[model samples]
Target: MTATPRAVDAKEILLTWLTDQVSVPVVSTRPDNKDAPATFVRLLLTGGTGRHDRALHTTQLTIDSYAPTTAAAVELALAVDAAVHGAVAGLSPVVRVSGTSPSESPDPDTTSARATATYQITTRLLT
Candidate 1:
């Protein structure tokens, strides 16, 4: 009943936290992968009530590779997602990733050699 508003508020709070993400370093040495260090992350989280008892939380996060190539953008996204999942796992209130659809947007500065992109992530939160 009253939990509906609470859920929306919680979603907003999480959205705010994600949109203003900070850059973190990458330390992966996989032979087939050269992870690109993250530069920045922006999230556009939006969602509300849904069918049945299921609630949804959708977030569109963006990342900048600084000077890496398209390949780098992917590694950065992984690191960012890992960091995000960890933080959410330790959230005060319990929440889970019911479903997730992550995609990478084309580079903004196509002319530049540096790689940069925005990730659109749709995450459903079932209450």
Candidate 2:
């Protein structure tokens, strides 16, 4: 008998991975604290796709790197890109990772500088 496939929480998997791999704090949303760390990473699930006949899922994630300076933010973004690509071999659920739209920009509402990148990740669903 074939087992049923289950939905994969890509955000949680990545959060755990980035938290262990990156130097800065990794969060799904911006911290509510007024004194939040100057350097941090935020992960957002933009969109995804799932195959009806296959136990495979693809997700689009936007990663925002925030720091005190634009250059620092950009550097952090690059680091995140590298980390995500480098660690794929160890992450079983993750089958592929493709990145795009790396840019350096500052947050408008806050003083922190922001750099952004989008990654398309394909994963094998657990059954």
Candidate 3:
């Protein structure tokens, strides 16, 4: 049988993923109401099983600004992945993102603008 990945390895990967999620360039767009710009970032993972089952863990990153489209979100996701690798390599795990959307407030705020980017990270436990 093959050996499973270690907790340290897994966590390291996750942490690295988290770091990448935020500190990177992502999808962006120009807003009609505002010119501040918007950005989105997120990281996610799910794995682990058997005698060395690790608890499920998730890391999420969201950016809400006037930057623009889902491009920022995509960039952020990639960045997060890179960051995690740089921060903590050897985290040989898998991660999947369900969705990436750009949303704005129906109502205007003092700034008269609203937008957001969301990201999710998740891990699973197997017996």
Candidate 4:
């Protein structure tokens, strides 16, 4: 008898990877810090797919880079893009990583400038 392949937590994997690679704090949700830094990255898992017969998983994520200024936000978004691509070799399970160009997306609630980008990460799950 053969055992079914296990599903991986794509969000956790990405959060862990980005936290280590990025200079700024990487969080899944808005920080509760009373004195939050001027720059930070927030990650949201938009969607994903997996097969029962295979250990391969693909996850889509939205990355929001926030800063005090629009220029700073854009710079941070670019840095994040580089860091995400750099993970392809370092992350064992990750098979590929792709992303769209970061665009300006100012936040409605705050005066902080924001940049947004989408990424697709494909990983091979361990049995």
Candidate 1: deviation at residue 114, Å? 10
TM-score of 4: 0.89
Candidate 2 per-residue lDDT over residues 1-127, each given as its tens digit: 9888886888889999999888999999988587799899999999966553477788889999999889899999998998888657978888889888569866777888999999988888888
What's each prediction's TM-score? 0.45, 0.91, 0.31, 0.89
Model 4 residue runs over 4 Å out of place are none
Best-to-worst ranking by TM-score: 2, 4, 1, 3
Positional deviation of residue 57's Cα in model 4 after best superposition, in angstroms: 1.0
The local distance difference test score of each candidate is 0.41, 0.86, 0.40, 0.84
Instruction: Report the CA-based lDDT of candidate 2 relative to the real structure.
Output: 0.86
Candidate 1 per-residue lDDT, tens place, 35-111, comes to: 43334333433443333235544443333333244555556556556545654565544244332423455645343
**Worst lDDT 10-window in candidate 2:** 48-57
Please list the residue runs of candidate 2 whose C-alpha ends up more than 4 Å from where it truly belongs after superposition.
none
Ranking by lDDT: 2, 4, 1, 3
**Candidate 4, run of 10 with poorest lDDT:** 48-57
**Tens-digit lDDT string for candidate 4 (41-104):** 9999898655533667788899999998999999999998988888788877888888799999
